[model samples]
Target: MTFESHGVSAGCWTGTLQSDRRPASLSVTHRGAVVVQAALREAGPGVWAVSAGLPPSVIDNGVHSLLLVVGDSVLASLTLVAGTVAGDDLLAEVAQLRAELDLLKREFRRLATGG
Candidate 1:
């Protein structure tokens, strides 16, 4: 995940990017824990980005989390922000898995028939 900004802060994980620039303040939480926090900065307009380098284990298990706070107030918060599992990459992986399953099924059928 890659986040770029001139003043805003963003959080990225699992191929999904979550950003908040309402007041130029942003916070990121993972598994109900705060991971990243960035203060607002004036950069002419408003531009900022945050990227989270998620480990393979996290992705394989399919987990996500997010949290935002503004002056002791919860502006936005979400848990399990799972993106499209049928996306291009996931689709390709699913296709491969299906093909393998098909092959195994064919082999099993053949063995059963022979027996």
Candidate 2:
């Protein structure tokens, strides 16, 4: 239902999320790169607990987002949330898309250059 990261901090940070369905797994990232991916466990009716030792790739205090791909469709999504896969995963996905785009751009450049 709520996640709180207290004590001394020097990285990007955000907090708290409420989702409709429980997620089975979570992925974290910052600026579009896969950071942490871990299993989820139900903590309550609608709340799930994130495992400890989140990957270092997770942006601590960044504008992270997440996409929860459930069975066939995406069940939950979060943008501008703290963790990422749970909320940061979306950013990682976006990063993937960007990489694909860059590849396309390179191909176009090569063609234009008469290579």
Candidate 3:
């Protein structure tokens, strides 16, 4: 079985799942817990349309990872970043990364302009 993500919209994640056999049970998990479960409907031969709602309880000021799973197998993942979830540590790390990136960009521009 293989799955192709169509991306998330309106707080729902969607994708096309292809399987030679019958469609399996689909569940959306977050933080090691099942958040949503939906039946996969046949879209075409060997194709299934998968959609699951992103639970509002999972939304908060932090990074959340949503997993599309069938049984024990994780087929896909979607990451959502909201406000400050990791506190100052993440902010500091991001600041450091941005500073390094700015330096790299400056160096790249200098080399490109032959300055």
Candidate 4:
């Protein structure tokens, strides 16, 4: 299996899977726990574009595995890093606060100037 994107963002991952033999089903897991059942779309002959979403319970930032299964056998396994860094999440919060502060500043200035 070849992945177009190696990272998971917004709880989802998109990639491509190539195989001579198509699997009956595909699934994703984190720390040996099943997280999502993935669906595949044929992009070309013997190639598929796959997308899967992470389960809400697996919230920690770390590496997770995707298991490609054909019947009872695991065809292949892929790894990915999960969750956003603390700094990134904090940056988003800071941007939101800045917007709110700007609005408050505008309101205060209007009141003080009586305009």
Candidate 5:
């Protein structure tokens, strides 16, 4: 939720940082390479805005995670997934959630029936 101004979309990422003082540095990295060397600016008192453009190579199918760094600390991240892989991932997650929900419902019914 740090990225308030804009979330990852249109091959770009945006985030916000709130601190009492300005950070020494800010950047975005992918696989340890600096994609955004310095893309931070003070938006208001104790608030800063950061943004970066995602590379085309990392935009392909699979999970793409971008790290947002403030000073030397890894503050936030943006993750994108696409293609059939993304669909499969979502389906697996949904199946797991459904299993858990079914378990909860059964437990609730057993307790309700005083079994």
Candidate 6:
């Protein structure tokens, strides 16, 4: 079995699961949290699209163990690293970079015009 870490958003995440066995059901459970039933859709043979929602408070920037259960057995167990869950820091950094780029553009224009 193979899985992809799709990052996190609003205490939820969407990822893809691939296995040789046709999945009957899908669910995710985080440590000390309730089991979240994932909404699964088959994308192709042995490929399942999944989305799981975690508890809001449980999404703080940290690593969490997420167990993927399919049918009556545990299919895959993995760790989800939550970084900038809301992406506030990332957005702020992007905005800062944009501002710096704008300043650099203005400086270049002034230099080229010799003004």
Best by TM-score: 3
Q: Which candidate is the best by lDDT?
A: 3
Query: Which TM-score value belongs to model 6?
Result: 0.50
Clashes of each: 10, 13, 0, 0, 1, 0
Model 3 scores a C-alpha lDDT of 0.81
Question: Scored by CA lDDT, what does every candidate get?
Answer: 0.45, 0.49, 0.81, 0.66, 0.72, 0.70
- TM-score of model 3 relative to the true fold? 0.70
lDDT of 5 by residue, 64-86 (tens): 66678766566776666776675
Candidate 4: which stretches are off by over 4 Å?
Answer: 1-6, 61-115
Off by over 4 Å in 1: 1-26, 43-60, 78-115
Where does model 6 exceed 4 Å of error?
60-64, 71-115
Which pairs clash in the backbone of model 4? none
- Report clash pairs, candidate 6: none
Question: Which has the higher lDDT value, candidate number 1 or candidate number 5?
Answer: 5
List model 6 lDDT by residue over 18-97, tens digit each.
87775666777665345678887788999878788876655557555667776545555555556744566556645865
What digit string (tens of lDDT, one per residue) describes model 2 on residues 6-107? 211343233323456765555544344544453466656666654433344443555545443333333334444354334456667578768967997998
Predictions ranked by lDDT, top down? 3, 5, 6, 4, 2, 1
Ordered by TM-score, highest first, the candidates read 3, 5, 4, 6, 2, 1
Clashing pairs in 5: 3-15
Tell me model 1's lDDT, rounded to 2 decimals. 0.45
Q: In model 1, how large is the Cα lDDT of residue 113?
A: 100
Candidate 3 weakest lDDT stretch, 10 residues: 84-93
RMSD of each: 16.4, 11.8, 10.3, 17.3, 9.5, 14.9
Model 6 gets an lDDT of 0.70
lDDT of 1 by residue, 30-90 (tens): 4545666644433333343333433333334333434454444444444442455545655
Q: Which residue pairs collide in model 3, if any?
A: none
lDDT per residue, candidate 4, 18-109, as tens digits? 87756677887655566778878888988887778866666556544456554455555555445665666656655855896699799889
My TM-score estimates for the predictions, one after another, are 0.31, 0.33, 0.70, 0.51, 0.62, 0.50
